[model samples]
Target: MSRTATAVPPQGTPLRRHGRTKIRYRTRGLAWAFMAPLLIVNLLVIGGPGLASFFYSFTDWDGLGSANFVGIANYVELFTSPAVLSAIQHNLIWTGFFLVVPMSMALLGAFLLSRVRRGQILFRVLFFIPYVLATIVSSIIWRQILSPTAGIGQALQGIGIDWFADTNFLGDPALALGSVAFINNWQWWGFLLVLFLAAMQGVDPALYEAARLDGANAFREFWHITLPGIRPTLMFLMLMTVIWSFLVFDYVFILTQGGPAGSTDVIGTVLYRTAFSENRAGYASSMAMLLTVISAAIVLGYQLLRKKLKWEV
Candidate 1:
């Protein structure tokens, strides 16, 4: 005869629940403890300065002495001021150029590289070299290369090329902004290529194989398989491109100093001038606030897009 066994529930059911709750609390406490140092550093470095800037935006402080609350006066002036408007327009142009030129070049370069077998590492290293170069160093180098008197133009002129011999790139108002953008793009697109290449490598090899089996050409393979596979990285880089374009100042400041009649004046340059050069720190703070708002809006918009579209990245 077989004997039947009866099951007994766990003893001290309330005790187990309490024990689990206590463990969870302890784990959370440890996590917070581990995060405390980073939180404090971030607060001191970013949060503090950000808050001070926000406060200063509403005041008429000249970077010294007492601050008087102006109550959006600076904002009104910022919107109406022609200099500010011109700077904003330049920034928009910069954004447009970066979003189109570098992004396209990077995508094409990365796609071509992804198809190559030999010398892939060599090519990647060569392309990434420019990105590793210091901004000031590159700006100085380009400035020399573009100089009408002693630069490549003159050197080429000695070889019977007169096309660029007399062209004053940074000195001409018409070409200053575009020249700066071009220089920045030279240093930027390589980095984008590397990033896009990395993203492409993460794509499933099987997808490309399947497309090839279906008699897909190189362009078709890239369009159908590669682009979709790397959409997340592409979109992210585009978003950052917009933001960084608006914040661009280093090359412009170093190369042209927003000169040739403010042709290359960006929001960043304008802010620097208004604050330090013009000694209108309060107004500059307002400009800073505007930049902050634009950056935050872009981020928030991206977040909303991700949530609405359910992006896995």
Candidate 2:
């Protein structure tokens, strides 16, 4: 019988493996050392206030002085209060408007812009200009544009156009919220277009060519290839839209301050009024908690849906 030969171990193999492991540990330690300062800052700035807010939510802390525990009274009032309820309703309406209007406009605009080979950058810059403008500036500009007297209505009336004559876009309680949403959308949709356009650019050109060869039209290619390719960006933006719609403060604060008989009041405006205006810090903290909970629930729901649907992105 032939003797089987065994393979010999390479010299210094264990030492080499040990050296690699040591190097990996050193790299990790260096990374942590670099990250430590920022981590500490975040803990102090964000985490500290977050914990304080949680503590204050359960107490009657009026921004200063001794705290007295009031349990869930703030929360009970938050749900039952008419103002809070109206703000919630407005937030829902705002969410619905943003989810549909801007998203659709961005998708269509991006798809169209993606097909253009000339002046694309110029067009993008033009579209994105409003997004970069300060919210206060944009709000002020829109306020002038929507002014009933000596505004767009007056200018149009000069041209003998009767439409929008004596129409108060922001002043009228019936039109206030929708008008604000429209103005916000003006600054928002372009930002979405740029992002969606960037996402669309990453999709394989080969697929588009193949679809064209298969006699597919613009709508079909967009429906199938473009949408699937940009789904992750779309989903992420949609998630942010929902969150930001609830947290919206700047435009509403600047434009109407939730006025015209509380027609434009949202959760953020109400929270601001409660804490600073009314000196109800504890109640405001509870509203803050409500916002935090709602945000968390939305994120959790998205995660669950993603898992359940087996989404790849």
Candidate 3:
């Protein structure tokens, strides 16, 4: 005798409530197809160039000439060169200042703004306005403002302070790097503040409520709740700052052009001077490769730290 198979529904359940499982699979496949173009673009634009750069770093290809193969000589020379070493140090200083200046100020601005009631939107717009302006435009504007004949310098001179004529904002080696750093922080803070504000808005309301009801003051609430809520965003911003610090070229190029006496030369400016200005493409590529490695190490270390943090949480 042949046995008959029976289908049974356990408990109170709806078996034929919606469409068949096949529909879900087809929907996922369609979604993947829609995302295909984006993936291709990312690979082509970002990944392709990165791979090409890595490959070129090993060869000597001067703009229009044939590539001559050199082993690790480029890297060897990079380590031996004092200018290169100083540039790397300057890059680190830039990164450090960026974290302390822009990121801290932005976070503080976000924290304060979140507590404000009236005209929040207006403040957000005002703070973010500077970021919308291009680096070159801002640099030019600052140049005029710092000029001795017409702007801050003139006003100072009118009071017998004479900051520009006496102190040399752009000409002094010791102060030029700080000047660029200030410009960078001033231009970037608005964007970062906006980002922090947006991220803060997404934090869970219940967490704040609970913290308040538990005898937590505003500072306490922020320490325990707000910081935890925006930890991920903070990590991301930190990483992005590090990457951008190393890749800084536009502002440095336009504003100081690697400084009055190479005092403000960071990795990017150094690389540009080598590759284009001095016609040492291979050497520049080697410096670039080292920078890439450093950036990767930082990002990787942060990711590992994040993973550990998640586990602890």
Candidate 4:
């Protein structure tokens, strides 16, 4: 019997590479398919406007007509202008208030709720109710409550309590900014409380039991166990709070319009007024760029700190 040999290619031939090529191509196509819509939308909405703002920040564009390049003049004016300076100062103060007030209230509220065995859901709902309300509705409700002529003040005056009877919270320069902060806090702290409570609920029960067995009080347990356990959530919320404080606009604009003599003016309001009211769109773009830079710097700093300290979150 005669045997005929069939040709066999050596190992690592191109014939075996076809499968990997097909897989790679398929994976790339699937990825693009999933990402296409989001990428397109982001390009249209964010990237376009952001690039335009960056370009216009170096020019004098009045929202119409030709844009003339002005170099860094707008930034110089932004830093030197007293209104902008004051607005920046107000932003700092707002950030401080949010960092301290809402964070403290939320942590305390969440801790208390976490310890509750009865009516926890009811208390949570009540606390979160204000956060669920529309911003406009909340602002109006607070405005009425703070109204001197026909609201709480008058009601209190009728009952012979005059402490806030004559107080014009939103109209007085000294009180306008603080009043807005208070109103915003009223709506904000509850949301934070719910978030913190959720974080606390995720904490290991064994940790708490261990702490109790060690004769640790509630405060010590919270300081040592709860805080570290929920560090990721707490840190994230703190970062967001800082960023939001800088971008705060709606409440101040609705309640005070950056007045009582611009006492409550923040960078957000100042940017709005500069762009639309004063017809300095270029300058407003500069302000927007400044805000973007600040936010970016904050995020970058956080990332660096996390890397340096080897934070898991």
Candidate 5:
């Protein structure tokens, strides 16, 4: 042994590499086992339906018989139809209001509510209650409340002033759409305010204390610390609001049925009418697909905005 050249092991090397390999193999097995159910559900429920809808969108299926594939003919018809086009415009306008009005108001409300000590929980409950109600139910209630000669109308008349006497809330071409959009805001902002307040609490208390010591008041602290801390939540909400705005259907359906001379029409209701009422399933599907593209573009733009924000934390 002494006379023979001794074999040397490599420096800082293990005698066996199998330990790490075994651990990694076990970890992967566990991960896959846990993920198996979720993967199955995703494939069946989400992926399957999505693919079917994509296939359906290319055909003129009346939810019966063999579907007739029409390719880009439906798309061509979508851009050419005035009613369909007007609904797209309404959807854009609705998206604008959803982004600007309710979200801004929610942020302000959350900020103010965070400063309160007593009855804060009650305030949250009261505000968020409306969000719990179904959109269709809320729309129906508002329809009654804003009735030209029935609900709020009679009350206003007793008060010696005409409220709905001049114009119908759900029946007027000019005011119906705006009124519906406004209701959407009213029913939505409270939930958003709660969400903002919840996200705000996750921010470090020490950051606020430091700001205060530096002579930074509430406004300054919010601008520098709070905004940055809650940036992700705000971004997510903004994107969601845009989608919901364009997809609004229950409220519009219940309130105006996409009427009041079609002033309250939007992409969702337009799609419904095109598919069922007009028996233009292919064209409706095309419009729907286009709407989906627009929504995706909006989401992409918001993602770019988030990157530009450069949130470090």
Candidate 6:
């Protein structure tokens, strides 16, 4: 009572607490050690170049000289440039096409594949094979297949079919953009199919069974259960599709080179031309910044939507 019954410390308690603390610190240190190499590499590669691009965007650097600060002149030109505007318009069209066509095809294909009890693996392999092919290889193959003189058109003409006999898919300004998109989609939708199939496989079978018991048809079951189950993957892929559509260069560059009167010219091709072909690196940098800003805005909009919708995914 006199000394408030001076509480006796539990023996080894402090040591036990200190041991846990030391272990936590050691664990954290080990994790950082494991992450250090990758972090350093990203900082050097991605971060450094990103910072340089941002700095050069405001300048008038012609790729090999002193960067003279021009303060938004490049940005102004980037916005006002006719070629850039045309490229952006094409990019928007491309984004719309990919957002609809591949996504729909993949979703339908994946859903059907999910119901298959046999030969599913073979189908998957066949579908994914095109996606695994190198872009250049696929582009070349499609180019040959779409050739006006010796391609499907000629093959069909041999069979007394005159539908595509005169069609120059890649050479016609009206057809070039669509032709490139179709070729890209041929290699793209399959990849999306595989991913959607994987995501669908994770959906609960019980839900489908319940839907069936409630007399729900295939489409209804898919609409209610399958879609919600794989929404996270769906949303993520759509986001990436939007970003990638803006950055599409490979297929266009290889097959069309944004040719046929620049009908298929996208932001990527324009940026390439500005930077290397035209020796306007600063203007190209500003274009890069525009792409970055657009991508960032899309991501931020997605985040806001997700938050507002209280999406658990």
Give the root-mean-square deviation of each candidate in angstroms. 2.7, 3.2, 4.7, 5.0, 4.5, 4.1
Q: In model 6, which runs have C-alpha deviations exceeding 4 angstroms?
A: 1-29
TM-score between model 4 and native: 0.91
Ranking by TM-score: 1, 2, 6, 4, 5, 3
Backbone collision tally, model 1: 0
TM accuracy, model 1: 0.93
**Candidate 5 wrongly placed segments (more than 4 Å):** 1-22, 305-309
Best by TM-score: 1
Q: Lowest summed lDDT over 10 consecutive residues: which window, candidate 3?
A: 1-10
Candidate 6 on 134-233: residue-level lDDT in tens?
Answer: 9999999999999998999999999999999999999999999999999999999999999999999999999999999999999999999999999999
| Number of clashing pairs per prediction, in order | 0, 0, 0, 0, 0, 0
- Candidate 4's displacement at residue 167, Å, is 1.4
Which tens-of-lDDT digit does each residue in 192-274 have in candidate 5? 99999999989999999999999998889889998888888897888888888888898888788899778989989988987
For model 3 the local lDDT of residue 165 reads 53
Query: lDDT of all the models against the reference?
Result: 0.93, 0.94, 0.84, 0.94, 0.83, 0.94
User: Which pairs of residues collide in model 4?
Assistant: none
**Model 3 C-alpha lDDT versus the unseen true structure:** 0.84
User: What is the RMSD, in Å, between candidate 1 and the native fold over all Cα?
Assistant: 2.7
Cα lDDT, model 1, residue 286: 95
